[model samples]
Target: MLRSTIGGLLIAFLAFGTAAAQTYRPAFDPGALKGPRAGAPNMVMVLGTPHLSSFPESFDPDRLGGLLERLEAWGPQAIAIESLSGPQCDFMRRYPERYRDTVEDYCWDPAPARAATGLEVPAATAEAKRLLASWPEEPTPSQRRRLAAVFLAGGEQASALVQWLRLPETERQVGNGLDDVLVARLETLEGRRNENTLIAAPLAARLGHERVYAMDDHTADAAVSDKEAYGKAIMAAWDNPAVAKRKALDDALADEIGTDEGVLVLYRAYNRPVLAQLAFEGDFGAALEEPSPQRFGRRYLGYWETRNLRMAANIREMLGFNPGMRALVIVGASHKGYLEAYLDQMHDVHLVDTDTVLH
Candidate 1:
């Protein structure tokens, strides 16, 4: 009788648990409430790419001619890159304890431009906008040079490069607020092999754009109390089969990027729909299960998501100002999935199929 009573109670508890699980549902879903949006929808293509700096020293800029041709044909009215904005860097500078490394690595000091223009990041940014707002349709070499100087002062080197590139080779000399120091900086930027200078800036120039938007964010950085232990915990979590496979795939792709076809193939693989799930499994998923008492994995995941969310918001804000325009975003491969998912939730934004564009 006692055994039978115990068995009956266990069955009753299981039945109640099942019933509760089946009845659970969320009260609200913002993703489902996409609405009666005004004007034409914004079109965005997020291009996932490996950092060009990782390429071999022999990597020629001409190797990218084919990739550049396709992007130019896409004709994006606006271009955004994975770079920290000057204003954000300035803001982060105040909190040096948390962001010293981030600022040093990502933000270019505008001291030279500041000296030439006598304006800080804020004023220079405002001046760049004001000049563009009333910019002449047929701006002279002098005007372009002046704007480039202002853009440099504003901490937008890529945009400044656009102006410098648009000018005739002979007209690229020091003048129109661009002193000797500023001219030298632009010259150095022209030979840079990184994506912003080689890809985004050149593409913007080819498409007759005045500037490229910097939408990356790193303000999510937090100084861990036990930095050494935190690093060890995260590294231990990453030592899984999924991570090994991801590394193998990345290594293989990096080797094949010698030609145009190779570059396109690499891009296609990175932007595959399944790559997102694979990335989560190898990275954030593994981290979430880390056995560290400090919860370092969860902390890393939080920072990753926060950065991507802020980046998506910056992109969305840019689109909001210029509705119905086509925009292309260039970012690291890891960020592609998170950015697309976040931007998809917006009512007026339409994500262009990356595969279609790459093809």
Candidate 2:
């Protein structure tokens, strides 16, 4: 009698549950399916670079020629550099008085370079394309100088810096329309930013590209909940050891860039899988081990991911305009892993084999 009573109750409960489930409806909406409107997956190469000038000493841009040549051979449709976005450049360009003081010290001087090329910032870039299209083999030194001047006037300082590198050391002086201080500042900026100004800018110019995309962001770093405490914790945890390791690696890489195929070797090692692992996964793993407020290690990683996601979004938007575009992203080594990882998730993006270029 007890068993039958329990079985009856079970049957009643099951029947009620089944009725409830049957009466429910799911709000499912499968929106229209879409395919790749952009022809081929965009190819992107994330080249990891060390912030060299962040150290006490900086290397000459010319040391990166071999690596730059390899990148140029890849023939990227666009080159995304780790700088302020296009709007920042335009802001500085239009109102030097307001932004000149705050903008990176390397923002181009419109006067001298423009005077040399007989074109303003807007016109100079167009003229540069025309010149490259009709470039002569074994052109006179004068032609090189003009193109360099045009590159500078068009706000591609790093490319102009390459033109400066082609001349003899003694001839690398600023004169006529170009200012001495301006020339010095270009080298300074390249070191500070750590792009192969030699690689990115010159290659863009060589391929008739008007400008390099700037995709760096500091807003994420600025928005930590407890900014001071978070910074102190990060510094205490990573700064010293990080600085020491980076300095040693940079010093060694600097020494290597002088030898045959040294630049290639340096880049290969710089872009190695182990380095990226250390930057993203390792940092996050270490963060997970922290305690209390100092445990902002996760937050640190969060901020990093946020910044890279935004950058990837920018690259995606850029691609929206030009289908099947190939872009090479020159970024701080720490950022390379995050950017590549985030971009890889996008359906229309196909990351280039960085090892091949590095090798």
Candidate 3:
């Protein structure tokens, strides 16, 4: 009688347990993705790429063809590029005097382009809106030649491209009426001197897209405090040993860039989340976390985060214009993790699996 009673209790407990299991709810629900602003959640995928000029001389293009094809095949509704454009470019153009010192020291040469456009930097800068607004839908081949010339002259390549694609397809030929200087420049770009020319614009053109989003943020780039002091503080506080080790790894990777397979390997590693975290660590890890008088590390981290936050916001706004969109962001590898972290916070945003795309 005791054994039978115990068996009955066990059976009852099992039945109750089975019922509870059947009623359990899962953590994920498709309904959670749909928000008030969007009919369905939008997906974001951030791809980290090496800066175009950062690659070694022996870098191969053949290997990247497959990668490019896959990305194009994925057919994202929108693609965000890392170039300084949209409002940031407007700010730079409006107050060249304020930003010129830094920009000229590092990147961009508007001289050749300005000279070719027959307008001074400030004059050409002022005309961007007018030109883009009135740009041709099907530009003559000579017009494309002229735009290519402008590119050689150092005109804003992104804006120039915006104007170029409006023209007819046949009018966009590079060699037509273009001198060797312009032709050479076109060849250099086709060979992938910069990601704008090498990948972003061309891929967009292939996909029949009209414009690419310029998502870079430079608002927090200016250092407010004693710049020299901040610099010194960071170098002193940072883990120099880690920096040296990363440099060694970078050097090793640089050596492998010559072959197509090697380039993909390098890029895949670059796009990894671990790599982005490592980048964050190198950029401000020790300085911000350690005890210090200057605390420049924290300040630096603050600026970086601010810039990334704004960038992510810009992307979100872009998505707001279209419902249920999938956007692909191509940015410098360092920005990948930050962008992803911030973008993931949006209520209706979904981050696509980068691992699947990359692998």
Best by lDDT: 1
Name the top TM-score candidate.
1
RMSD of 3: 12.4
Clashes of each: 0, 0, 12
TM-score of each: 0.91, 0.62, 0.71
Over 39-64, each residue of candidate 2 has an lDDT whose tens digit, in order, gives 57678888887764453344555666
lDDT of each: 0.90, 0.67, 0.67
Backbone clash pairs for candidate 1 read none
RMSD, each candidate, Å? 4.1, 9.3, 12.4
lDDT of candidate 1 vs native?
A: 0.90
lDDT per residue as tens, model 3, 296-359:
7887788778989988988988898886887888888888888887887677788886667756
* 317 Cα displacement, candidate 2 (Å): 1.6
TM-score of 2: 0.62
**Superior candidate under TM-score, 1 versus 2:** 1
